[model samples]
Every structure is written in C-alpha cells, then in structure tokens.
Target: MIGLNLRLHWIYVPYLSSGRSIRLQINTVIMNPNLDDVDRKILRELQTDGRASFRDISSRIGVSTPTVSARVQAMTDMGLIKGYSTLLDADMLGQVSVILTINAKPSHLEDVYERLMEDEMVRQIFILSDSRLLCMLSFYNQVKYKMFIETISKIPEILSMDASMILKAPKENQRAALTDEAGLLIRCYYCGHMIHDEGVKIKMDGKYHYLCCPVCSKLYKEKYEKLRKSA
Candidate 1:
C-alpha cells in the first residue's frame, strides 16, 4: 500500500492539446537537499490552501512575506513545486473515472504511448516494472467511453488493455506531509544530469541554480549571461 505521507506530484511536458496536457509522475527517489523547518512550514501552508497569498502564509508561519515569496519561487524553480490546481467534484460533474492497464510489445511500446498521449481523456499514465502502462482515463458518459475504447482498439501497437472503473474515492488529493527528511530532486541546469552530492549552487536572476560540477557551473553561467545580455 502507498503511504499517505508520500507526496504525489506530476511533471508536465510541452505536449498540449484540447486544453489538456500529458503529465508524467516520477515514483522513484532522487538524491537532493532535505527540507528545512521553514521549507516544511511553507509547503504545509500551501498544501492546505494553494490559493493562500504569500503574505497570509508569512503571517501564519511567523515569517516575513519576502522570505515566503522567495522560498516559494526557489522551490518552484527547483521543480519541488510542480504547479497548482483546483479540486473538482467529478461525481457532481457526471464524469466517469476508469483505470486502464495496458500492455504493448517491446518494439511498439513508444508508438502506443504516443497514441495514448493524444487522447484528451487520458489524465495520468504510469510506466510499470514489467514494461506495462497504468493509465487513468476520464469521460463524460458511457457513449464517449465506448467510442474511446473502439478508437484504441484499432491501434496495432497495444497488445492488450484492461479497465476498471473507480466507483468512489474515499480520500482523494491527500496532501503530502512535509517532513525534515523529505528531499528535493535536483538536476544540473546545464547538463541535465541528476546531482547526487553537494553540487555547485549559483544565484542568478533572483533564483538559485544548481550544477553538477564547477565546469558545468561555469558553462551555465556563461550561457545565462549571454541570454540575459541579448535580452
């Protein structure tokens, strides 16, 4: 069973269609900085109310407004904070939810994955251990659901698919309890490599940037300065 304390977040890509985008979630742990007291406090506040202003969070946490703002921005740049979203009552909206377990041949997995990404009803997708995919799909009614099934059935890459409807969600969108041990996944801004140690850190444009080495730091700084100068 998944623990309630584990944070569920999505990393969004550039592919957008029909006012919806494909989101990929990372399930494995990555090495980075652990959360501090102030960081935890700010995340907790925002998790409770995403729309809370930085001033309100500062007052509640007994920190200055500027500090709250800076921390939030830094976290956002670091990808620790993915993005904000509003919760909606799917039941009231007459939306049907289903979980799809999909299996594709090794040679055609990417083809099948791309086809699914074009579907607006496909909300979330997870790559499983055995090279299968677990997808969450939403639809307005049975008619649309049947249509989607028929459409995907024509795809040759998808070997098999199993679907299970979600009848009810007893606890949905549970907030992650930010603890001191919680770590942020850091990556090199220049080389796009994961930083496993105390990597180089530099502040530019009022935001902190991480690099895996001194060489990367130098290169990233030069590139950033060039971009800024051109701008």
Candidate 2:
C-alpha cells in the first residue's frame, strides 16, 4: 500500500489594513496549445521517451526526419517544449517529499513567490486564496526538513506555515496528452478573416475564441460589448 500524509491547520491572524488580501489565479487551460495533430504527436513521442532520436520519432510518427527536427525546433522556440531532464527516484536518494502551505503578508506575496522559486529544494509552487502559497519540497530526512523549515521561517513575509508528508506518490510528473481531434482554424473576431499564423486567442463568457491578429484581439472585447448592446 502507498503511504500518504495529510495535515490541516486552521489559524487566524490580525488584519493590518482595510484593503482585502490579494488572491492570485493560475491559468489551467487544458487546450492543445494551438498546435496541429502532427505537432501534438511529436510532443507526445518526445515526452514518452525523451532520448528518442529524430529518425526514430519520424519512423514511428510516419514523418520525415527533417520535418520532425523542424517541428521540435519550432516548439522549443515557442517555449512550449522546455529543456528535458531525467526523473530520479527519491527513495534511492533517501529523500522524503513534503507539501508546505504558507500564508504570507499581503505586501510580500511577490517577494515570497520569487524566493520560493529560487529555492532548489522546492519542486513546485502554487498560489492560493489571498496571499497564501503552497509548495512541494523534498529532503533527505526529517532533520533536513526541520532545518529548511527554520530557514524559511526567517522570511518576514511568511505569516504561518503547515506541512504534510507524502508517504506514497502513485503519480508524480506526467506530460499533457495528445488528442485525435484537429485544431480549429483561427479566425479574426472583428473582420471574420482567417489567421494563417501567430493569431491571438482569448477567453470570453467562459469560452475561448481566436482573433486573426493582435489588434483584432484587443478590440474584440469592445465588439462583444457592442453586440450585446445591439441585442
């Protein structure tokens, strides 16, 4: 059986100002990053076997070697494909995974975020409701974990912190999945023109739509309001 540690703490602190605490929201859109099926297949193959050669990928995906290479390069340039790395076993390294939930002063949200990002032990960070943060950290043992906690406590912005130990991790890092559906052709919101490349996409009224260019995308909101006004 996989062991997991879960902890929760409820604590209240005094508010310093009348202004409400700022809350940060992360973009969790699950779209295909505006790429076609061929690109998606290339990404899926590379993610499955990072060391796979271009020739091997081409053989499996039924594309030319040069085409595969070009697609990979384009994805990298677009920042969709970050640099690859090897996944190591934490048990073999005698390490334990811990999740940390922190409450920071409203004034120090950005500072705390930047500092946590720079910490090598932190694997991931999440912004939560109102100056709150969650971080995943790994350490060799409890002694190291305590030391790291004490170090982080020194940060003036940190108001409170809670920790949960991960006894068993069934799933850790997984890449995005590829779908068989074809990508939608982008069209301008204003002029209804087709976008060949580098078009803008925006979400309005809980739906996402494409605008052929930056200018149209920027002005689309006004167009939406006018349409509403007319109706």
Candidate 3:
C-alpha cells in the first residue's frame, strides 16, 4: 500500500463474454489513496454491488446524488477506486478456479504478468509489494492441478508457484482488506458498459455512477444534450 512511489504499467481493458480477447499494457498505477469515512463507506457499498444505482448510494450516504457523484469523481481522480467486478459462480461455469500463490523471481514480476497475461484462462492476478504473487485462475476442472502448476513452473522466471482449490461461500462475503484498488474499476466511460473486475478490467469515476473514460465523459455530455433537445 505504501512505497508504490515506484512507477508501474497499469492497463485498462475490456472483459468479453464472447471469448474475444484484448491485450493490455499493464502499468503499475500507483494508488495514492486518500479517503474520508464517507468515501470509504461509499466504496464499501459499491463493493457489495457494482450496479447499485446512484440514487441508492445517495440515500444510504444521506447525500444528494450530485454530491455523492462529486465525491466519487474526486476519489476516482485521485485513483482510489481501481475497478468493479461481477462475482461469478465459478463452479457453475464448469471451469476449475483456484487460488495460486507464486513466488517467482522478485525481479521477474513484470515478466510474470507479461507471460501469464497471454493465457486466456488466467482470470485475475496480483503482485505483492513483498515480492510474492497471488492469482486466481480457472481452467477445466478435469485437468490435474499439478499439471498446470508444472506448466507454469517451466517459466524461467517462476521461482515457486503453489495453487489450491478455494471454496466459495453460498452467499457473498467481503474479503479482509489488503488494499482497495478493486472497488473503483467498475465504471466505464465508453458504451455504458459496467464491468466487475471478475477477470478482465476497465476504468472509473464512481460515486454512484460509472465513468468510463474521457471520451465516454464527452459522449455522456452529448447524450444528455440530445435528450434535452428532444424533450
């Protein structure tokens, strides 16, 4: 959480249901997170439900939607909310999803993302400040876990990677705080798409509504303009 003063390559990308893929340049986006209690609360609520309407967040936070919107915008401008993701029923999806902790060569962290990102089955991955790594990956449940582990072990940069099956609670639960980048990436400024960083990703400006990007912001302005004139 601290000392990310180091520059990183962060990439914004799209999540596709049709099996289409988009390659992204992963930059280490330093999160200079500054939060008040309300900002934290807004994040908590949003984390629970990415699609929660702005009206709902405003009501819960006891502020007007515009005020909630303003604060969310400010937080996003500051890079607090990294993304939002849909919590999928991995088992239902018929692919085996498990948590893998990799202790690849510390210097090889970038290489890990570079090589690992090439695999479509690799869902979500993270790099630890302590030079360790953790990833959530899903493939055929029928495939032996060790076989997959062995395949990765072949990577010259991988020091050691261990993976285990994770059990999902029947109901949703909050993960203990490690860091808070995941909550902000839910809003997209383009095409009104809302993504939960379930696997792929996008970017944000979210108090209650999602801001896709600068272009989407302009599109929103024009969209409302057309609406106003038509009315």
Q: For candidate 3, lDDT tens digit of each residue in 69-182? A: 877665665356556667777678777778888887777888887888887777777887767778878877646665767788888888776778766646646554624443
* lDDT (C-alpha, whole model) for all candidates: 0.78, 0.73, 0.61
- Name the best candidate (by TM-score): 1
By lDDT, rank the candidates, best first: 1, 2, 3
Candidate 2 pairs with clashing backbones:
3-168
Give the per-residue lDDT of model 1 (tens digit) for 167-207.
99898765465767776667789999987744666668787
Question: For model 2, what is the error of residue 81's alpha carbon versus the real structure, in angstroms, after optimal superposition?
Answer: 0.3
Alpha-carbon RMSD to native, per candidate: 13.2, 17.0, 15.4
Model 2 collision count? 1
Clashing pairs in 1: none
Better of 2 and 3 by TM-score: 2
The TM-scores of all predictions, comma-separated, are 0.74, 0.64, 0.53
Write one digit per residue (lDDT tens) for candidate 2, span 1-231. Answer: 001122232323333485454332222212223566678888889888999999999999899999899878756643457789999998789899999999999988999999999988998898999889999899988898899999989999999999999898888766354566634344465788866635555567765565555456545766797988899
